[model samples]
Target: MNDHDNNLPAVPEGDEPVPNPGLPPHHWRPTDVDPKAEKRAERQVAAFFGVATVALLGFFVSYFAFQVGDNWDTIAGLGASNLMLGLTLAIAFLCIGIGLIHWARKLMTDQEIVELRHPAASSEEDRSTSVGLVLQGVDDSGIGRRPLVRNSLLGALGLVGLAPIIMLRDLGPLPGDKLLHTIWKPGMRVVRDVVGTPIHVSDLEIGDLVNAEPAAIFELDDEGHHVVEGVELQIAKSKGAVILLRMEPGEITPWKGRENWSVEGIVCFSKICTHVGCPISLNERTKHHLLCPCHQSTFDLADNGKVIFGPAARHLPQLPIEVDDEGYLVAQSDFTEPVGPSFWERDKT
Candidate 1:
């Protein structure tokens, strides 16, 4: 009935007319309109990539320069080694991201395109054409022809691979015979951890649990002692730490061949969980259950640290204990069997 109705496209009696909105005006970028600006942008992107290469090289240098245990006070509580390593590696990744963005915005072709709707499945001809387009893009990247860019990218990637290799240091040296031994020895006094004082039977009470370690494990001889320092100390302590729990004498049920392993009602078991080597000490005195916080593996302290519940595949290894003439508790000997989680080499024979 009006100019608007006359201009609108014809529609079916009950169908709605489609709305029309023209595309927005295009605005050309500085690099797109100027050749010199384009070249400058390309160089700026390349410079960013160059800086990224240097940062990656610095990452490798920091990896080897700083020891894991070095003092951290040098950088406002951040270790010098960690600070440099993190900064260099972070810059390396950040530069690459920024460089790629700059290259896309300034150097790569930018044009608006409109594609009509098509079926989800592509025709064989369309597929072949798409493959050709991908190949053409790869060729345009000049990765094979530009030795400087190609080599730098390759070198950066190679340095990145070193991160996982360096982390492998945490897996540690093959445990070997180390897992089979500890600081425990004949007549070595059992001492409370931290305070390093020898434990007497009188120091414990019924329903009491005390976390203890071998006195010799923490002792320094006149010329200083051997074993249990650095990585070795951490590994040894992980497998050697024990919990001493005292129950009512009538409540104790000793394992066979372990009748004399306890001093009075005081019994000792590995603090390391049997499930996956978590240091377990949570005690339920009324139930005689020692719970591992990691996986909730429960062991019965009254019944030789046997796995009573949860995912533990084996029992907590028990240490033999006795009172010496000096009235302090001491190990009769080192653990008769391996402690902590079971290993592939464990009990193989």
Candidate 2:
């Protein structure tokens, strides 16, 4: 019916004629047409892989060279260990990606192929053909022909995996008996947490709850002694923290042998919830119940910190307390039991 229709393929009487658009002419890249350009592209790809190798080497150097929190090992106010590790690892991955792209675009075959649609399941002969095609693709990638690219890429991959293994050192020397102890010891004064002022049993009223810590955090000997500093101080405070509450002595139902653990009506227990180690300060003062915010695990302070509700497997650990000659509350000794979340190796014995 028209000039466009004249180029259409013929059809049977019942079927409509369909247009046949011939494939466009394939355009060749500069590397395809010129031997010199092809050689330059291959060298460029090799150089990218070489850079990847160098970046990976830098990563290992940075790992051992920079100590965490070292003042001299900071760049732009961020830790050099973190900054260098991130940059080098990113460059190592980026170089490999860029090199692969350059190799595919410049040197690898770019011919148009037609793959007809077929059923999902293939015959045994088709599977064999697929394996042969995979080998053919590997050969076409020039990895066998190019020793430099292959070796450098392999080296980069092998070394990059070592970065994580080196970081295992940060897990620190095995815990040993360190986790079983804290800054709490005999005669350590109980002080308010943030202000670090010594607390007296007479200072608290009935139904009063105060978050407190060890007095070693605030005191200095004749020569300005330091009990704990930096990370050690933080770890000590976290494990040694306590909540001091004043309730009617008649309301308290002390456990066996713990009858003398409290001073007057004032009692102290660990602030860390036995359920997942959440900080619990929420108090039901009238009922003498301590509620953990994380899991709603409730402990009865009146009954030796017994688990009254929720999913906690252990009761809140109580600290032994006695008033010093100065009338200030002090620990009789360290916690008789471990505090915080329970572990498999914890003293079930």
Candidate 3:
């Protein structure tokens, strides 16, 4: 009826005509209209990719340059190895993301397109059309024509994948027989933990539990320095730890061939729980039960360290003991079986 309505497309009888609003006017960007601006933008995107490449190189350098706990490798109160690896890797990933964004925004094809709606289901024609569109998209991305940006992006991604592969070397050279044996050997004197004082049978009372370790832990060399120190000392102490419990001699139910393993009424067993290798010391003196605090795995020291309750599948390993000439308790031999939690090769023998 009015001037605006007159421009509308004609419709069938008795049907209302729908107004059509066309797309907005197109505005050309600086890079789209000018050659120099396009070149500058391309350089900027390439520079971002270059920075990403440099950051990735730095990541490799940092990975091998510093050890985890080096005394001199501290930065901002954090370990230099961790700090540099995190910082460099973060910068490399950030730069790669930014470079891709800049490339898409500044250099990729800029246009407004309208596509007619079609059926949701696919057919032979739709599949062919989709393949054509994918090829067109690849061409529009200009990756083939932009060698500088493409190569740098490919290099960064390749390096990122390679970094993880290099770290797989730390998985191990295999523990071999290390877990099968410990620092405890024949005639190793059982001393009180922490204080490192030798223990005599008279020093213990009935129903008493004392945490003890092997005497090799406190042995001094000719220079007066501990023979077992550093990481070796820590590993030895962990695997060689035991608890000496004194109960009435008649109360103990010794297993076959273990009647002489205890001295008088005191018995020794590995402190590590067999379920998950947690250190256990909570003792129920009334019942002679040793309870692991971590998961409630209980062991009865009076009955040859039998598993009385909880999730422990195996009984605690006992250390055969006898009194030395000086009355100090000593191990007759190392543990007959391996101590600690279950492992893959544990049941092989």
lDDT of 1 by residue, 1-349 (tens): 9556779655667543444454577778898899899768767766767887788778777766766754433467677777887898899788778877876777555656555556799999989998997987777665555455556566666777776777586677765687787878888888887677999899999888888887754545688865556776655555678999998777888877989898888998889887788889899988879999998999998888888899988888889999999889999999988887888777622
lDDT of every predicted structure (CA atoms):
0.79, 0.87, 0.87
Q: Estimate each model's TM-score.
A: 0.56, 0.64, 0.63
RMSD of 2: 6.3
Model 2: which residue pairs collide?
Answer: none
What TM-score does prediction 2 earn?
0.64
Q: What does candidate 2's lDDT look like per residue over 92-186, in tens digits?
A: 99998998899999988778775556679999999999999999999988889878778877887888788788779788878887767767888
Candidate 1 residue spans exceeding 4 A from truth = 1-7, 10-51, 66-87, 90-114, 117-132, 144-148, 161-183, 191-218, 221-267, 276-309, 336-338, 341-349
TM-score of 3: 0.63
User: Candidate 3 residues 1-349, lDDT tens each?
Assistant: 8545779656668553444456799989998899898889888877877887788788788878887643648788888877888888898888888989988988888898865556799899999999998999888988889888788788888888887886785687667788887778778899999888999999999999999999885555688856778898878988989999999999999988999999999999999999999999999988999999999999999998899899988899999999999999999998988899878777622
Candidate 3 — which pairs collide? none
Worst 10 residues of 2 by lDDT: 14-23
Candidate 2 clash total?
A: 0
Poorest lDDT segment (10 consecutive residues) of candidate 3: 14-23
